[model samples]
Target: MAFTGFGGSTSGTTDFTQELVSATGLAERDRPADLRVWPNPTPDGTFTIDAGEARILGLEVLDASGRLVRSLGALSAAPFTMELGGLGAGSYTVRLLTDRGPAVARLLRQ
Candidate 1:
């Protein structure tokens, strides 16, 4: 599967959804080379993403079924706090775009 950049869809909703699902699935499959996420199953309110030596450009949170829940823009440092209070109780994926590569972590809401 190919990686698709983040954007809205003007095409058919079904096609767009499929493409997004495929792209996000592919991204989750390939782990980042240098980033890390602490407290594996994250607490419901906040969490951190550590980029190690890499620079984190942004972060995206996805629901269990691969739906985009939130996009965190332009992190200023290696470890950044993300608010998860509005998220529903379930499993979520946190994807980080770093200087090294993309990093993905599974977050659990309690």
Candidate 2:
């Protein structure tokens, strides 16, 4: 199956679910080669998006329950700095809305 970017249904309801593993036991499609966040676990909210060679237009910070907590909005380019100082220390996931598709990574706030 192909990744449909972010999950949104025609019924007009919340659908934040995602398939962690495809039927083949791997991501349906490959993620950006270098799309990553540096300093996985950061004490401060300051973080950087590596971009690697991809163009990430937007970002969404989700809680462990897959609920969207914050939206970084659309970006003009990649390798940008994100200030999540408002978030509390805990486990979180950063969803990179890239030009190619979506990429998710674990983020820890200190």
Candidate 3:
């Protein structure tokens, strides 16, 4: 699937409901790859993002209120480590942009 870009409501805040999509002819449910976040429920706020065979292009971490808290602009690696030590303990959403498509995973900081 080819990820065109971010799209959502016109209210202002970005809605990440449309996780992945196909720009060509593939179906919407056809995901090119799987995005994995390990060490979930992290105690130290450190975790890893693994995109399987897909290469990670960008990464974003959003708070529970849908506010962007952390972002790693453009990247070219996978299975990398990230630390959220500065952020308060709470639930966050992790969004990773990959060559195949966009992958999202829930993260818990403690």
Residues 67-96, candidate 3, lDDT per residue (tens digit)?
A: 999999766666789999789999999998
Weakest ten-residue segment in model 2 by summed lDDT: 25-34
Error of 2 at 9 (Å): 54
Give the better candidate number (2 or 3) by TM-score: 3
Error of 3 at 78 (Å): 2.1
Scored by lDDT, the top model is 3
Error of 2 at 14 (Å): 54
For candidate 3, the clash count comes to 0
**Candidate 2 segments exceeding 4 Å error:** 1-33
How far does residue 101 in candidate 2 sit from its true spot (Å)?
A: 1.4
The best candidate in terms of TM-score? 3
lDDT of 2 at 76: 74
Full candidate order by lDDT, most accurate first: 3, 2, 1
Model 1, C-alpha of 28: deviation from truth (Å):
21
lDDT computed for candidate 1: 0.73
User: Which residue pairs does candidate 3 place in steric collision?
Assistant: none
* Backbone clashes, each candidate: 0, 0, 0
Q: Lowest-scoring 10 consecutive residues by lDDT in candidate 1?
A: 12-21
